[model samples]
Target: MNINLKYFKEGLKDGVPIALGYLAVSFSLGIAASNAGLTALQGYLASFLCKASAGEAAGFTAIKEQVPYLEIIIVTFVANCRYLLMSFALSQRLNPKMNIIHRFLLGFYLTDEFFALSISQDGYVNPYKCYGAAIIGSPCWCIGTSLGIIAGNILPAKIVAALSVALYGMFLSVIIPKAKEDRYVFLSIIGAFFMSFILSFTGISSGIRVIIVTVLIASTFAVIKPRSTEDE
Candidate 1:
């Protein structure tokens, strides 16, 4: 396969910002993993495999709860369902003549940040750029997770607790921008928060409760405020 050195180098530069962000976010994730009794290596592997914040959150919740394997699978899928849509959008941006291997590899590398970078590029998207970004960004995520776990184990409890709050702050940063841009998204987020709060009083396990709240809130919004074709 021919490497586009220019695009690849540009990709590496683009990935730096993403790598830095992942280091902080995945550090909080590692603390959560440690709280869930995961070893540093286990947290590293999990972060390597499950790249999304929401997906990793759900997986760690399931593990902490000792939920059944099927429940874990279902929750993880539901949390990550948006990636399917992201993949569809990205597929349209790829060169149709691109090989299946590159297509598959790009799919694996399509985290939210990378997807935005890839989709915004002019002309046909080269898989090599995604590869370059992943090469730089992914290891930092994994290493950050490992470091978080180690820090959680060694650091003062109060310090770890404070650092863990960064994950929620990062989530708010992501959604607040979209919420400002789209009322429907804002409403959905509000509904999810309200529903999740109510569900907290129930005897339902956190895993099942999340699945219920997400499905209900999303389904309600999907029906009530269906996006126009242009929105897609």
Candidate 2:
């Protein structure tokens, strides 16, 4: 088999399971988007542009609450800060011959799952393989979200309302397991709960409050939490 074909086939094989999982998670994102007053087309477009399930879900919620664009910007940056580190790590794995534009475009598919898989490779990563993973994974995410939006529109209003709240539960399911592995994460989770509770009583708009709480808590932990030499 051709070298490029071999690389793509391997990436596609690895990507298939991730794509299937993304379909399920993004489905909820679609429903949440519809509940937030976005049309199916808008929801699909938003996911395409944002390409992030957590940030988009949070942003959609903020948009529903009628926040200013500035708040949305802050929240988005806060939500996506982890990707900053992941991108740097992935860049180190790419060969020197890879074009800058290809590296930039490959970052589009660097979901938590994709990054995990890519970084686990034993040697220099193949750019074409990454592209193949993106090709398979990105579509599953986009199409799943579109289907969710369609389903959200079709369901009864009461049912849709019930389903919308599940997004929070979904977030917790992801966060709680990880939080259990680290003390700082657990403390941050608790801190966020209290901070959010206090913010609830304030006159600040919901979006601004979320943005402020996230930044404050995250920064505080960043400073207090011990950094690993590996990251240095």
Candidate 3:
């Protein structure tokens, strides 16, 4: 697979938004890592190795709690189970003729945003184009994580706390765009907030409560309003 200049340029362009979003989120991760007693270099290494926001967050939390290494591994794996579904979908998009090496390269770059962008494109993906996205996106993810760790080390605790809000803000930004296009998503957001608040007030364990409420509400709605054939 010869990746051309044009493909690389396109990947860089497509990756810009993701890079911007990642900077904030990765910075928060770095801050959390620092607070968890990890060195700046260790934080960067973890981000580079995992390449997953949720998994890294879970790992940090687990580490902070002095959880065993096996438990940390389990938590990280569980947090990233969605990647399995994403990888399965992407496999369907690759050219059937592509070899194992090509698949492996594509898998390396298979982040959530990258998968969404790749699959949303029409027709089968060119291996070079996938390579281009990886070339462009990987650095943003890595560099942001590195800088965030460095910043976390040098900055005051209060400042780090303030900057941490950027992670949630980034999530909101991502969701807002999608919610505008999908009424169901918008409603689901409202339902989630309401359920979370009610559960919190009632003294439920926040994590378990969220899982229970989300499952119950989402399942009930799914059953009551099964997707129409047209919607499907």
Candidate 4:
């Protein structure tokens, strides 16, 4: 609660670009939510509570299909499980003395963008910085989803389809730079892509396929190219 204004302001500034990207991506997600028969307010609440696009998309699909609640839960969990790893890494970077409340709050806000920014900090993360980013980015995503639901109803199908690509573009923007810097990252991406494509032909659900591909590729690389202790 006693966040430093200076760090908070810096986090707000750093969050602007992330907020913009989320706006576009979540708009497309709203369209998906609409397709799933979700009301604008429901879509808004979903985005507000759950920041993972892949997980949200899978959940929406499950809703549309009228899948059993257990299946829906499993799909969402598998799709969002990567965040558990991100959370673990971020926990290690936190000050050891930070309180449980702040830790839980940061864990709740631990999206890919926020985790990347926080983990890349020089030392232990200032909770206020993450708070500042969440303030600006999270609401924009929720609002964008609501607007997207409204737009999907009024806009032409072609326009909605075009807008949906924004989410894919946002993901590429995140990964491409890292891939260029690390060949292993690039290879992992390529491997995941091919595996995902092959799995698409199978009867497995999209969410389950994602977990299978991610675990296999990540485990393979961890063994094949274990990081040095210095890197760790």
Candidate 5:
């Protein structure tokens, strides 16, 4: 085999873990989608194209609740907006001499895992390695969603209902660990929970409620919390 091909294959081998991880997480997303009255095609397509599980989940929730289109747009934006920062950071790691198309594609596939791995590479990153990682992981995400949706349809309603809660559990799993480390974050999370609970009882719609609560809390924290000069 050619040296370049062999090196690319090595990158694919490294992506095995990332692909497996994507499979599990997106499987949960599929269940969420199924529960949300989304079609199987919708579930897999969203996972395949967006490649951002959190954003997709937020969007799915909005859809499930029958929130307005504008609110859906806002929720998805707020959820996935962090990717812009990740992309900016990843951009600095690439060789300036690399192709612009490669740079664009790299940025496109620069998920949290792929970016971390690419940035860890010594010196300027080879775009091919990132491609290798994306090629493996992206398909796994889509495939997992497809399988989950399919399984949800075939399973009993009780099983599907149980699986749907996995989305909330996933969010908690992501937040609780970090919240444990920081008092501010912990407080913010607790505050958000209370706010959400309060909103549930009021005449306020889910769409407006989410927008109001998220903007209010996040902006307030942005002003009061400490700011760091370096990026995460």
Candidate 6:
């Protein structure tokens, strides 16, 4: 197994955005975990395993509601289904000649941010590149989360409250760009809120119900839309 310094450098460079993005997001997760009654260690553990923001949010929501563990797992899995697509995309970029062990190792680090960076490469990813990403990106995620947990404990309540806004701000940052570029995205946002508001009046589980409604509505639209001739 030859270690390529170039690929390592490339992975490190590509992982910079991931590190920065995780910093803000993990900070908010720390705050949320603390508020949700998780200890700092537990919060760090959540960040280490879950990594996905939506999963953590769903888990915390379930915890708050005292939902069954099965429901929590299901919600977290559903929230992260998009990662299946990401993983599929990344598989194409890996070296075909690589062994199963190598592939398995690569798959372990197939995070959205890491996949995005890996696929953006000009050619097939060497094992060293995947190794580099796992080495650098994994630590960034884990360390940032640990730091967030620590900060959550040390920071004053008022300061933590102010910092909590950063997560919403991050969400808005993603939403604004998609809304500006696509009318359908803008409509979906509005539709989601409307459905959620309506569902809130019911006595059933609002969060789970909202997720079901959104998925059903979105999937129905996708099925009804005419496919391009090229796609066919």
Best by lDDT: 4
Clashing pairs in model 4, backbone N/Cα/C closer than 3 A: none
lDDT of 6 by residue, 1-232 (tens): 3357887776776555556556666776666665677776787777767777777877876787888878988988777776666676567666678689877766776665656555545567665655665666566566666666567656555655554464444356546666686676677777777877788788655445556666766766567553353421
Compared with the true structure, model 1 gives a TM-score of 0.68
**All candidates: TM-score:** 0.68, 0.66, 0.67, 0.74, 0.64, 0.62
RMSD of each: 5.6, 6.7, 5.1, 4.0, 7.2, 6.4
Q: Which 10 successive residues of model 2 have the least lDDT summed? A: 162-171
User: Where does the lowest 10-residue lDDT sum fall in candidate 5?
Assistant: 162-171
What lDDT, from 0 to 1, does candidate 2 have? 0.75
**What TM-score would you give candidate 2 relative to the actual structure?**
0.66
Cα lDDT tens digits, model 3, 1-232, are 3445666666667666666666667877777786788887788778777888877887888888999888987887677766776687688777789899978877877776666656644467766655666666667677667777677655566765555564455456556766697687677778888888888888754445656666777777778666563442
As for lDDT, the candidate ahead, 1 or 3, is: 1
Candidate 5: which stretches are off by over 4 Å? 1-7, 153-232
**TM-score quality measure for candidate 4:** 0.74
Poorly placed runs, candidate 1 (over 4 Å): 1-3, 153-232
lDDT (Cα atoms) of all candidates against the true structure: 0.79, 0.75, 0.70, 0.82, 0.74, 0.65
Find the 10 residues in a row with the least total lDDT in model 3: 162-171
Off by over 4 Å in 3: 1-5, 153-232
| Model 6 alpha-carbon drift over 4 Å, by segment | 1-3, 153-232
How much lDDT does candidate 3 score?
0.70
**Considering only N, C-alpha and C atoms within 3 Å, which residue pairs clash in candidate 5?**
none
lDDT (Cα, tens digit) per residue for candidate 5, span 5-80: 7657766976776777787777778888887888888888888778877788888888889999999988887777
Candidate 2 regions with alpha-carbon error over 4 angstroms: 153-232
* Residue pair clashes in candidate 3: none
Off by over 4 Å in 4: 1-3, 153-221, 224-232
